[model samples]
Target: MPGFDSEFTPITRQRLFAGERLRAIRRRAGLGQAAMAARLGISVSYLSQIENDDRPLTSAVLAALARHHPFDLAAIEADQPTRRFAAARAALDDPVFAGSALAADALARIVEQQPAFADRFIALHAAYRRAEERLQMVDEGLESGGGRLPWEEVRDWFHEAGNYVDLLDRGAESLALRLGDGDGALRDALAERGIVVATNDDPATLRRLDRADGRLAISAALPPESRRFMLAHQLAAIAFAEPIAAIAESAALRSAEARRLLAVGLANYAAGALLMPYERFRAAARAFRHDIDRLRLHFSVSFEQACHRLSTLQRPGARGVPMFFCRVDMAGNITKRHSATRLQFARFGGACPLWAVHEAVAIPDRIMTQLVETPDGVRYVSMAKGLVKASGSFARAPRRYAVALGCEAAHARDFVYADAIDVDGSGAATPIGISCRLCPRADCDQRAFPPADRAIAVDPDIRRIVPYRL
Candidate 1:
């Protein structure tokens, strides 16, 4: 870079931006682009295009960057890994799975656990996005006529589950619920009442309880945790499922499918409660700091299963933190979320980058704590931890992930991870909200989409630094 500074061109910055950290390194070594591309087993044309900002860097190339230049791809990916999952969601768009809540949930899990596959799916989705965008520009009205987006429903399911299964586990622990022998226990318990657990692989049926054979089958491939949840639902369905449906009957849903998913999800929550008896689980939660992994082992539930149960700790006088939770893979798309709090989180839209939940993806596997205050002065202490997936089998192993949790800052003093929260306490912290779409912080660098209720008013008279002047 010393003597070559004058010879350098725009291509230099382009290559650097495309995950090629070694560009400057190679130049420092006095190697040419042709030489570097030759050593990389790639063509000079591709390298030239990458160098000149003509091409995007794929994960494959980013992986190579890590090997060759020792850069942190996870740090680089802090921008948006959820794009991978959003793409995979586009693949499982078959009407059959789209209509089934179980299939939709499975699709979400797959996308989150297998980002490489998700990336391919996203590329495929990008094509669709382009076509749809072009068609919209041509005729926006025609593009509006379709069934509700399946992804939106699945997103709600996750959010309702509170980002991870830990909240569910916490909720169950409040009651001392335990899923003994996992799915086997639910099946045995159901069999006692003349109900049998069955699998319906056919694309036509999902979660149908066959009374004639006294068997219940789900139409999708369920992970063990989900299977246990479904079985638990069967037991609850026999008793309170009808009652829960009665409740939903009076409520509003985006669609019949969404309503059904919500009803069954509640049934599953009830079943989890039965296994964990209320007072006993609450005692355990008080004993354990609400740490999910320990609760999972104690209750014999999966991490997600445990987290899901934790979100339900609200019952009149007995309540834990009225917490809001969410999970995101390396990408920004919210994979799951849940809230008893008043926060109305975005189900599929991007969250503000400044939010601690979004930052959790960067420090995978370790717990990250933050003291975040909303622009309105409400403060919360947030904690995030990384989780690796294991299916007990090879083919369906899920990818690793990190999740975050936070409670009102007033209650932050009671949590163990609070002391490490990244707060300077001098009020220099960036103001953030539940989602960028809802946040009103005009000076926020992380603002993406404007809040739904606000309109952007641009004045032609003054030159504004930001895109829109409100």
Candidate 2:
């Protein structure tokens, strides 16, 4: 409870001029100048001036508009100009640009004078970084259609989409509103379809559906939260089948197996959305400073489910704190990964050994927090916890994994885990990276291997933790 309510604190800015964003809101609402002006209780000329950037937006008009419309006022107040300026600066700071980085003033000038070019420059840098990452990653298989696996193809599809399916999310939210009841919603939904829902004592499968007998059985071995999630997943797979199929079919996947995998992924996304309705869940998460236990209890969801849902809160306007979420098995294999921030997870091999998630995997049920700086100089506050799911019988082994969730240091105030660390102290962070092969920190003593593309020279007489020098 110490860091709760941090996100509700108001932010102060020196100036606000987001005319383009205001104009976009008006266009999205399909309202003409006169109508928009009337709704905001302002004159048409005044509205036109504001939209054209001839005048700054006042708080009173913004308040009036928020009262009349369903817009995310916080997002509007965040100022696109400031965001673009920061993005331009960050892209320039990438090591690829190194000593040729532009000054803050020069970057600001470009953002102000040629916004389109600035945007393009940032996008090009992102593409370059992605290409660099792919090159750094170990080849899973050949790039040809025959060698690419369905799971990998589906993973890439979700990654490219930023793990957010807008249409499916909104549709699931609508269904949630209709259901009203919490866990009972899933049962009622299945019951309406003439299917009897019950729990099965079998430990072999999570859930089994028998259309022949019009019955659905969920594994009784699961915890209460997971049971509910499994129910939602089964229900979503049934209700959202058409849209899920459409999305899968729309993908440029080469094989039928890839399409099938994509459809399952979409259905899983929809199930999470249905169980934790976006607007309500995001609001609660902000209130709790993204406390996983608080979120899981409030939403009646599993911890992993809550963490996974947090990563998908990228709904443009009503976005939550941007964060990366991943799950690591006991072997340090990252089974799940997504980033709404600059921190990308390694696509192959284990994650960086210095990451706290690896430590959490050894110590189950305890939350571990760490302040880490990636090679790019961006700091993050991470919270990781190891979990064990019961197998309900001694004959079977339980599933064990650790989940990590974190955001960049800029949003540290809104992330509760950062409270115990010094966010402003540059030297307080432990240096970390995506993986050993992808990391650029040659001085790190815990490095497992050298960069795949960088040649190293070995000193025959030299003695150090690592035998070779970069």
lDDT tens readout by residue for model 1, 1-470: 00111112212222224435445444532457887676455688877777665665533343343333221233333334423433344344323243544233344345445656767765765576446334422332233343336445544454434433343434444333444445666777788889877777753444788799897887555555656667766777665655567755654566777777767666666667756555565556545656666776776666666555566666533445556677777777667676654344554455668876666666656667677777556566777776765444455555566666666653443355565664447774556776665566777655665665578877778765667754
lDDT by residue for model 2 (1-470), tens: 00101121112334466678888766644468998897777899988988887766654454454433322354565556545655666566555575695544455556656888989998999899888656644332321323456776788788879889999999999999999857787888978878788889898788888989988899988888888888788788889889898998999999999999888888889999998999998888877878889999888888999999999998977877778999999999988999988788876658999999999988899999999999987788999999998898999998899999999876665677888999888589899988777788889899998865588998899989999998
Candidate 2, residue 340: how far the Cα is off, in Å? 0.9
Each prediction's whole-model lDDT (CA): 0.56, 0.79
The ten-residue window of minimal lDDT in model 1 covers 1-10
CA shift at 460, candidate 1, in angstroms? Answer: 11
Q: Find the number of clashing residue pairs for candidate 2.
A: 0
CA displacement after TM-score superposition, residue 325 of candidate 1 (Å) = 1.5
Query: After best superposition, candidate 2 residue 102: deviation in angstroms?
Result: 6.7
